[model samples]
Target: MSAPEQRFTPVLLTLPGLTPTLALEILPHGVTLHRLFVQADGRTHDLLIGPENPADHLTQKYTNTIVGRYANRLPVNQDAFPLSRNGHSSTFTPQSNESPTVSLHGGRVGFDYVEWTPLLDPSESQLFTDAEKSHLNGSDGVVGVIFKRISEDGEEGYPGRLLVETLVSLVEPSGPQAESVKTGSELKLGSVVIVYRAKLLDEGKVTPINLTQHWGFNLDASLKESLTVKEHTLSIKADHTIELNNVGLSTGSLLPVTGTHHAHAEKESKKIGEKWPTSGYDEFYVFSPRSTPTLPTRVPVSEFTPTSDLLKEIITSEASSKDPLVQLASEKSGLRVSFDSNQSGVQFYSNNLTNEKNGARKKIHGGSGVSGAGDSYGVGSAAFLEFHEPLAAWLNPSTIGHSGNDTLLASGEIYNNFVKMDVWFKSPVA
Candidate 1:
């Protein structure tokens, strides 16, 4: 119960060359990802959904926020989970800033709500080289920013002093991808790459850590119309899901998607409306360890099962390590967002709680378009797709059911991960 930290101004990262360029806002508060703008079809549209200001939320919910210390959840009951290393054992209590029932998003004062400092002169802390920059884009000009923070030992009742660095870069198309722009044969696509690196500052002390960008996206340019995400089409490459309990906690069961909306969607894309009967998608899709990592096959964005009135763009694959774990397309704008990550799993949460205010049902307008100091925010206004380590990996390290890897961030080891977002838009014939 200490006073809350002061919020800082937002910083913008933009790619200026592309017609419909990409822009992102990096907020000092909670090191949050605030605003995202993509130039598509002769228009620049903001794609993120949440309150305009960071202080208006009754609950942080980590909207477009950087979540960690431990990203997801760690089970802590009457008999807390036991942790042992080098003959030392400790119990993780459910104590958190979130709720007494569980430890959510690094407890009450988790990094999401706290002020994060950027390293002095990001240019001095440049982690990428000319070759690395060239790999991102052939363009002479590229833009990037690096933010860093130090988590004191036991800051959130977590062990070890942890140092985290995040780099947000807007790299334009390169090689063949860049050539298509001149030919006007292919839809231009640029990337917003997030690089995360963390290390344990205290020797011989370990911590369970997971980090993610809680991104909720909507592709529409005109917000005057009442928009619901039900019309969006989605495709996920995985075949299995990590099950969840009623309150959004993992049940430690890796189950086949089967007849559910969370099924393996590589062959075909499905509409969001089809899953209306359920609580939307709040499950983790597991990429099989047996599968080879390779570049995704390109296809028309329109191939994601577009409806006539809604289809505004075509989908094409980027040269990524694998096909996107999740592909979301809007028929209205032809704006398609493909999400890829090195993390073990992806969490999709339909902004189902936007309409709920102070625990009651109410209509509140919130998103990048409107101020969110109101009691209620936009309900189902967008969809949150999170890239991170598997849920409950800390509780059941051996049984968390990630493809093949475990979740423990050992002492003296660096945890490096990244998430990529590719936005493609198609214009109507003049």
Candidate 2:
């Protein structure tokens, strides 16, 4: 219990049920912070940069740290979320409020909280080779963490003998940082790149898998009150959208959200806003370049200054001394993101609030952070972000032992998708 007030340290949880084996390296840039490790608990999971404060989860109270077992809920009508829908398996399935269908991420013990084991070096021969294996020791410039889990047949009511393994790596930054590391091993102007790969082993054969992370982003501490993301523009070059059920669950309908009005204004009004009830966004956004308007490549779409509301593409958040403005721009900005997944949908939430849990606010120690008081952090400081999702698969072992004969579900064949995110930060305008 030797915890410091304003410093960062490695946290180990000896809680029950968990084997309590290893711990991750805590990374803090300043007041903002996070953790980094390769081999968690026993399975593999990565947030690219590990896990940020998740920006926003459960209204900033931090309830939903990572993606729940299932990204969203299953359709009320379906007995269970169908592993295969139509001809394609969508990674980001939509949300649903109906019937037995519920939300599930990695089911109970996902990757986020798992303590990973670092495999520094597997061997030079294994490099770039598709040999399908595991390594704990990572390289000096890179980090590799590995983890695995075997789900029981009826764990989450799925049907698959689930033997899943994930590998996460932090590659060396490719920018200016790589050039000036002459003195030692220090990076200058490069960003950390995260990569995740997981597969389901069936009778020692490769099967399909789905996975994602539940990462939220809040530019300003108090996402809503700061009243800025508008400055943060969104420029999405996607062509297809998966129609979600009432609660946002993917109904297996991948279409375009462009022309679909939340409602028809007596067939007269050209401007139609979000559907009647809720305001905050809770829908999956597809990344399709084919359906894009193809604006300039380097220009960013300022969400703060919305040109259109087809999607919450980018956000612009700024604060001026006299009347500061937060702006997010995207002129396509030579920046493009591609999302390929096995699930059906993606969810985005804003941190309108945070937890007063420990009486005051929680200051992030591993990364750059915002204060609750705007200039300083106290109680109730919030964070917001857009994140990936990891899928959930229930395995059965009481029957087949090691061959993966009795499976509750085929699980992650669809969610094995990736999101291409390029986030840029610049000093506040003078």
Candidate 3:
């Protein structure tokens, strides 16, 4: 007998209005965010960079996909940690997938490559409360889909059986109280909200876990234009960045962003191409604890109610009281995207390694009489913003203390990761 063929089905989430402002495509393979269409300037624009065909996602490198077991890189030699629950104790050790020296994004077969099961009736989910389920099922103009998966114990050199649930939703602007900003036009604002929840199913067991979405963005709207994100301006609400070694792993040191090209403060926006570094950015930016409201690392399953109000609180807190955690605007499209998350830090990558040689495809417009055809993308074609705990912080808390107990999930505990992206059109003057 032959191995069974994998099936890929995508779910679409949209607002309640006849002319919805936003639409999101959730691909089951890896529970990837396949595409995001935003209506602006009387036209619909695709804000995310992804493959044209759904199956093409398998060939791409974490393109708009949820990555985990562990999100980022981990040292090859991981120390065994003790896990004790109800007087039962055992040692846990993490396995590496990248090479003998490192582990990149889970293991060789991480969540990114797995096919997640879609929950047709989200009410049956164990991760949401009744209030949250009602709110997510169209109340307050919210629509979403939940994808669930089970990671068997020792699947990726990690302990415990993990139940993971990912909720991808679109929340439209509700009334005057809706979290929005005035750009050039009086466009109603909306957002793409992603919530990741996980729990250990094994009794008296523990595991190390870190989860995140790796979505590459290009505001150009069309691949035919073949524009790079260097033309975009960016701002971040961070004062320090995690120091990295030559191989790109955290050195357990936090360094100031002042007086550096990486210093794109909330008040000081800078063009990504101006004074650019050869390697582009693959660094982790640390967020100040006092800058945003404190969020719990673990929520009891019974009390895990992520209502619309909670979503608003996470994204709007920055919109109302402070600048967004990170902002990127495109001058060509008049489109801007702001991100806010409960994670302790973010990773900004400029797609430095993407190019025609890497099999990235883009539409090429012919000159004069020549016809247009498909072509490969070049380096810096897009910007990737990953919201998650500081990389490798679980190994050395003293050096990256902002994320206390974020990567460790104990028995009977639930882990929640929330991220929101608000999109709207902005006039050049504004």
Per-model TM-score on C-alpha atoms: 0.80, 0.48, 0.88
Residue-level lDDT tens digits of model 1 in 1-430: 2334335466777776535377787777776776787766566666776555555432545778888877776665666555555443444554554455668877767878777666535534333323333323324445666677888887767777777777777766544554333343335467777777676677666566778888777665244344567778877766677777766678877788778767637565677777665555567777655354522111122232223211001112243424666778877776777766667777777776566333211122222323332343356667788877777676655434333334555454566667777777655433
Tens-digit lDDT track for model 2 on 234-351?
3333344446555545554556556553222122322111232234344444433222221111111122122321111111101111111111222211111122222222443333
Task: TM-score for candidate 3, please give it.
Answer: 0.88
The residue-by-residue lDDT of candidate 3 on 257-371, one tens digit each, is 8999889876666898886898888877887664445556677555654552344454334452235678888878788888777787788888887654444353211112111
lDDT of 3: 0.73
Residue 216, candidate 3: how far off, in angstroms?
Answer: 0.7
Comparing candidate 2 with candidate 3, which one achieves the higher lDDT? 3
Cα displacement (angstroms), candidate 2, residue 14, comes to 25
- lDDT of model 1, residue 216: 76
lDDT at position 47, candidate 2: 21
Which candidate number has the best TM-score?
Answer: 3
Let me know the TM-score candidate 2 reaches against the reference structure. Answer: 0.48
